[model samples]
Target: MDFFNDHKKLFSSALAFFLCLTLVICILPALDNQRVIQPLPNAKHLTAQETRGKLIYIREGCVACHTQQVRNIDMDQVFGSRPSLSADYALNKRMSFLQNTATLMGSERTGPDLTNIGARQPSKEWQFTHLYNPRAVVPASIMPSFKWMFIEKEQLGPNDIEVSVPDEFKKGVKGKIVASQDAKDLVAYLLSLKQVELPSNIPVREFLYKSEKKEAANSGKGGNLPDGAALYTANCVACHQASGEGLPGAFPPLKGSSVVLGDDLELYITIIMKGYNARVPEYGVMPPVGTTANFKPEEVAAIMNHERTSWGNNAKEVTAEEVKAIMDKIK
Candidate 1:
């Protein structure tokens, strides 16, 4: 009772108690975690360009809409091959003495998780185009255009990198769109966000709460074919619109393309696996989606059938066996 009456003594005691609690409950646990968790062996540090890009990423508040984390759930499986572990973020270093490091594991997911975006979409051309105008690549995207990151040049410099933007999304600019140093740095950082493979000795964690419907589809149970429409939506729908009409002068249309309707299965399979880059300055280089996603024979067949039959293009549907044979030879 006397001690409570002494205001200074009481305040000091309270402060001491709070510090003790913080030490036991927060600091101790964090220190223990630091000791136990180690970065993955294959994880690489960010390059100079990538570090600059990361600062730009923070400056632009990209973490507001996009997250770098992949939670341990079936829904998050699309973002990464496996559930995220503490080791995935162990290699992250502080930006500087004044600025502390952030995990960038954002709370909201207005856009897709970028935990494995590097492996998923590695094409620099596509990244530049998408950044300049999201609607140019994804017609239904709600993302705001980062047009300021690009420069409109009447004539390109010798070392200038050009971005092929669709006329409709150009906002009436006649000049060629070229990526700025900031844009290049930002894309470099984005491209470095890949999930490294875990060591063989450690047991891989499984994504929990997988729905029976998804399980059945994945296992191809009951003689059912893989869902072509879903596969296309996941992989192809971003660049090629839902109507199969891609942006002109940016991405080639697949509505009535000879490649889709042609009888050349070998050529089609090769393009999907290895990707096509010869159409540069006209269309952005296509990323190796099939290879990145690790598409199975059945999955490839399903996608081929979907593209061939839809958009009023009635080409011959491919079989899993045919696709597998081609894949084997190509590989």
Candidate 2:
């Protein structure tokens, strides 16, 4: 009380001076630079739509459910890649003055880190369709579709900008006049998900996991199955007994099957794909697990080709490429 009473004038003068200094010296400086944002490595040059998506990602709070980095010592190796370095990020500008700024950097990983996703999932078409509708491929995905990202766009022509549809997608593009920019940008961002820092523990070969350049698997070439007798013994011996007599009411005999030598190869292909469970009610149903789905398309085609040409039956030999082309549609 005594101090305040004695220096009332002095205290008032000092408080006013401090307020003036805060506004003029500290606060005003921030208004110029605004918020300085730094991007992760490889994202330095962003497409226009990708840049928009980045802001949308922040706005929608996607970071709440997803993480962007995995530690070397963590148990998340199965679902994620390795940890990240700020140096790996693509800085818009040199950040030598981080010592002088309060950056907008946050570090909380709720969902999987997106650092390696673009490279992990290679198909841009798949990603776009997935974003448009996640429930289609993954029966259980938590991510929401940013459908607004796919608005129509135009291209600049000689005189001015005009809308057009390219020749390739013209057939099934629903005859839409314009293309989706959001899809293009989203694909750009997704492709940027290359993991340049894969650890040594990860294998050099895997189609399902890991980010690496891969040539498409060849599925159309002819195969090298064993001789007719050997293939019959290896594949058909269990169902059709060695005596050429099938198990009664359990398995149908292939010794006199008509479909084996049928004119329609599609029927044979269909039977192989859909497994013959009920058609041959006397025999249990054949499984529908596709060869291209789990095993290499070639392996399945080889077995089928061998089956159709065995047990006193002679049809055509199937090629992996033909099976692959067929699976392309079925898949």
Best model number under TM-score: 1
lDDT of each: 0.87, 0.50
- Model 2, 1-331: lDDT tens digits are 6656778777887899999999899898755434443343334465666665555555566667766654454344533445554434434333246432121233665445666666444444445545654543343567775555553334433432112212332344342232255455555656665555433653433224445434333232364532434434533444455545554544455656676656555555565555554554234454443431243556556656656655666766677677667656655
lDDT of 1 by residue, 9-100 (tens): 99999999999999999999988998999999999989999999999999999999999989989999899999899999998877888887
Candidate 1's clash total is 0
Query: Candidate 2: lDDT over CA atoms?
Result: 0.50
* Predicted structure 1, TM vs. truth: 0.89
On lDDT, the leading prediction is 1
**Model 2: worst 10 consecutive residues (lDDT sum):** 160-169
